[model samples]
Target: MELRNRSAFHEYFFETTYVAGIVLVGTEVKSLRAGKVSFNDAYCQFHKGELYVKNLHISDYAFGTTQRHEPTQERKLLLKKKELRKLEAKIKEKGYTIVPLKIFFNDRNLAKIEIGLGKGKKLYDKRETIKKRDVERDLKRYVK
Candidate 1:
């Protein structure tokens, strides 16, 4: 199952994106496969030179045993050292932050997440985005 954080697109202008593997527990994997995840207020952070995603809610598996995983715990992300350094450097700059864009399973059945380096949008920018979307929808409907 592929899940996207649509609100992230509305709030930030993404400059670059990276697909990284996630560190998940047993129940977490099952929950993800079952599409029981939420990206509310989820974002990425750097800790001790490693990348980790915080506030990502992967719900508990319905049939899981008593040893359930925490839904909003911080989870590590796997990426190359070079890429991590690049993201870290960019994050050090003003107005640059890391946001979780989407999550999907690769062909190998491994869970992966797309993270983006983005800058927050201003009020007018957000309005323009909404206006553009409305225009596109109207145009598509007219053509159909």
Candidate 2:
């Protein structure tokens, strides 16, 4: 995995997920392979009937020329019409959001992002998750 939004799991309960292709420039792809990406504060939104991810940061490739792509540009996401419509419907629901969960390369060496339709978790729910994680960590240490 090139990048992950760990906060997404803690802040929201994912109800649906979709694997979408990201449009990228050459330098951006190189940066991804070098593990220089951040999904923090990233989100998906529809513009002119197309899905795009905003605030995703793919750092410039170190060896790139002056044509290096911007790190925080809005990138278009490739999804089928049916999936897009489904997501649009889900998003229209109350308290739901679309967020990028992780970025990775497929067998064809193309970049893809796994985005989720999630509902924001309550404060108590977040605390519960933290407690569960701590318990799991303790259990692992005990086992070892």
Candidate 3:
């Protein structure tokens, strides 16, 4: 299956449970099925005791006209109340965030989003991650 967006492992220090859900809107859902979505720079926020994803871009359906939904509008995330509370607690900690790891469809033909509770990485941390990946790649190439 094709994944819409994948969070960088090095950039995210931690990950929690994976949840699945359906997204609202007609044109938005159609656009998502077409893989016309981007999760980069997108994150979740708690508003009025509910979770909403912000900055996520779901391109307007090609056939949709001016009535099409906004590309960067906040999208609601469906999760149980218990899960929402847990996420809210975790987010209260310093430097913690919720990021969308991937968006895909399951066998039942429903759209699902995989979200991760993540911690931001510093500049040097990201550089180190790149360096380690390069070393691993070189080792694998040399082993052949």
Candidate 4:
């Protein structure tokens, strides 16, 4: 499957899990199917025991008028209660965050979002990651 924008892996280290079932407006779903969505700067937050995604941009459907949904409004994420509890606990103890990794359609034609449990990386850690990536790239070129 093709991936859209990926957050800087150097900036956030993730432990990921797959989650299913998110409610979206008709326009949003249509925009997504047309590949007019952006995950950049999007993040997940827990509110009143439910998870919500904020700052995700789903562009307006061309056929839609002013009634079209806002591009960056908060969207609810569907997850089990037990899983929510587990995520809450881990976030509290480990200072981790939830982020949307990817959005895709499953075989059933349902929209699914892949979320990740992650920790923010420090400045030095980011530099280290960049250095490692450069080295890997160099190695690949040399091998070729």
RMSD of each: 0.8, 1.3, 1.9, 1.8
- The TM-scores of all predictions, comma-separated, are 0.97, 0.94, 0.89, 0.89
lDDT of 4 by residue, 18-93 (tens): 5747789868888888889887888888899889999989999999866689899989999888898998888787
lDDT of 2: 0.92
**Cα misplacement distance, residue 92 of candidate 2 (Å):** 0.9
Q: What's the CA error at residue 2 for candidate 3, in Å?
A: 3.0
lDDT of 1 by residue, 1-144 (tens): 799999999999999999999999869988988889899999999999999999999998989998799999999999999999999999999999999999999999999999999999999999999999999999999999
Task: Name model 3 segments beyond 4 Å from true.
Answer: 4-7, 65-67
lDDT per prediction?
Answer: 0.96, 0.92, 0.82, 0.83
Top-lDDT structure, candidate number: 1
Model 2 stretches astray by more than 4 angstroms: none
> How far out, in Å, is residue 102 in model 4?
0.7
For model 3 the TM-score comes to 0.89
Best by TM-score: 1
Clashes of 3: 0
* Tens digits of lDDT, candidate 2, 1-144: 557888899999999899999999869988988899888899999988899999999998989997789899999999999999999988888998999999999999999999999999999999999999999999999999
The sequence of per-residue lDDT tens digits that candidate 3 reaches over residues 18-121 is 67584667688788878888877888899999898899888889998666898998888999988999999999998888888788778887788888898889
Backbone clashes in each candidate structure, one number apiece?
A: 0, 0, 0, 0
Query: Candidate 4: global Cα-lDDT?
Result: 0.83
Pitting candidate 2 against candidate 3, the one with the higher TM-score is 2
Clashing pairs in 1: none
